[model samples]
Target chain A: MQLDNTDRRLLEIIQRQIPLSSRPFADIGVELGIGEGEVLERLRRLQEAKIIRRIGGFFDSRKLGYTGTLCALQVPRDRIEEVAAVINAYSEVSHNYLRTHEYNMWFTILAPSQSEVERVMEEIKARTGIDSVLSLPAERLFKIRVKFNVSEVPDAE
Target chain B: MLSEFEKRVVREIQGDLPLESRPFAAMARRLGVTEGQLLDTVENFLERGLLRRFGAALRHQRVGYGGNALVAWVVPPDEIEPVGNAIAAYPDVTHCYQRATVPGWPYNLYSMVHRHSEAECRELVRRIGEALGIEQYILLFSTAELKRSSMQYFRD
Candidate 1:
């Protein structure tokens, strides 16, 4: 998708941070030297295009008394969809991906407690009959910020 | 350690914010609080490090970063910090962490790398490996995103 310089800058700035104000869009417009209406219009288009998945507060789950772990399973190629459905049934499971590896199904489960996460994992294993679920919890978090460098994207203009 | 009202605020803002003028006012109407109160709560969350950032969660693939791979590195205990930092320094690498490796699967450090193309992703991975002098790594390319959603803290 071609993005003009203004749209590119908007994407970059919004990813870094959005101000906590009643007129947050206006605040962003002020920074980008565009009107709030223009900012909203561009953002609406971006959201529709699925470029901007969401715009909201990113809370630290751990600080909020939640625990999470990354797990992977070596599901048979034939049953990938079935196994994924069982895994995704749990609200605790936030991210589930089919990756290219022996342990092809990789996912992350976040819950209010370690036991809750474990319970969900175990249930997923039992439901899918994939017992060899590797639960790799984070020993250390070096970084988690997911801001992409949109400024580097060539401007359509 | 949050009050009832604060918890409600957190639940309200955890998902997508409305795209409009005075969004907080719209949210405030739902929560029976003033827009000022909601903004203050969000600011406090930021100051307390409870909220990482209020921003757009982008789809990197749509924005020209099509190549995505999860590279897992088996770094030595003594050199984990330097190697992790080296991986984290790359802007394209969004997430970096040291995870507990299982018995058969022996990869301790993990980094999510994104680039414009598969070749570029491989090249960036090569550069990172060269800089860190760590070759024991495997890149796992995601074939499909089955599920992706933000954590909903207080379900109401």
Candidate 2:
């Protein structure tokens, strides 16, 4: 699944933004000098390849009356998987990773309210019995933009 | 506050938009709104900062960025503003934040760095440390990605 120059350019454009138009793909096609059908076909293939995990709106959950926090748990080496399963059971937990630290398990939870976030944390603690959980909410956000320079990198995988 | 229609639009498009010639058409139909109406709402969301972005979310690994790390720094409380802004300026640094620190955990500023390799990631971290003139930090490379998914809202 090698991405050619056009595919690369397409990825770059869409990762940054897509037109807010009734015929957005047609607009992208014009920009790419292709047709709407080609744009749709390429993007469909990209989605099938799992290169594009999602294509949609990313809302500021905070503005929508949601609260979230970064949480870490110190799970014993043998119990890491079990504890992670417990924490990941909640839909609020969007990301869970095993990192190289004493507090090895780190995850993020975004819920409808602050109390909902707290409730999820409490339940995780109760189920896993990992009382050494640390919830570190963001005091300030400096930046959050996840876009890669697909134009430069060749298909490595 | 979000209008009722806006909430419905958000609920419909928070997941992947169908890959079609007119991706918003089906969504508009389901929500009982015209394509123009739905797109207008999304455009408004972007203008109002309710939506951070509306586009493709790429898998970094698939796109050749195999190495990623979460670097935590222990910056002095007063310098958080300058230090955070500096880190945020880097294109490779995707997320930067000043977070609450717990006892025994003094690292307050966190940044997520992506590169082609672990060695490259380490070099970037070292350069950042030198440029920022900060000493205490830890590079927590992910040993495993237990779960990664987008948040679903208004599903009820």
- Number of the predicted model whose TM-score against the real structure is largest: 2
Q: What is candidate 2's DockQ?
A: 0.86
TM-score of each: 0.96, 0.97
Q: How accurate is candidate 2 locally (lDDT)?
A: 0.91
| Error at B54, model 2, angstroms | 0.9
Taking the tens digit of each residue's C-alpha lDDT, what string does model 1 give over B15-85?
78998898889999999989988888898999999999999998877777767999999899999998888
**Candidate 1 versus the native: TM-score?**
0.96
The per-model DockQ list reads 0.74, 0.86
Report the Cα lDDT for residue B136, model 2: 97
Reproduced native contacts, each prediction: 0.90, 0.93
Q: Taking the candidates one at a time, how many backbone clashes does each contain? A: 0, 0
- The regions of model 1 sitting more than 4 angstroms off are A155-157
Sliding window of 10 residues with minimal summed lDDT for model 1 chain B: B58-67
lDDT of 2 by residue, B1-156 (tens): 877878889989898888777778888999998998888888889989989999989989889987899999999999999999999999999999999999888999999999998899999999999999999999999878899999988767
Model 1 deviation from native, Cα RMSD in Å: 1.6
TM-score of chain B of each: 0.96, 0.97
> Who wins the DockQ comparison?
2
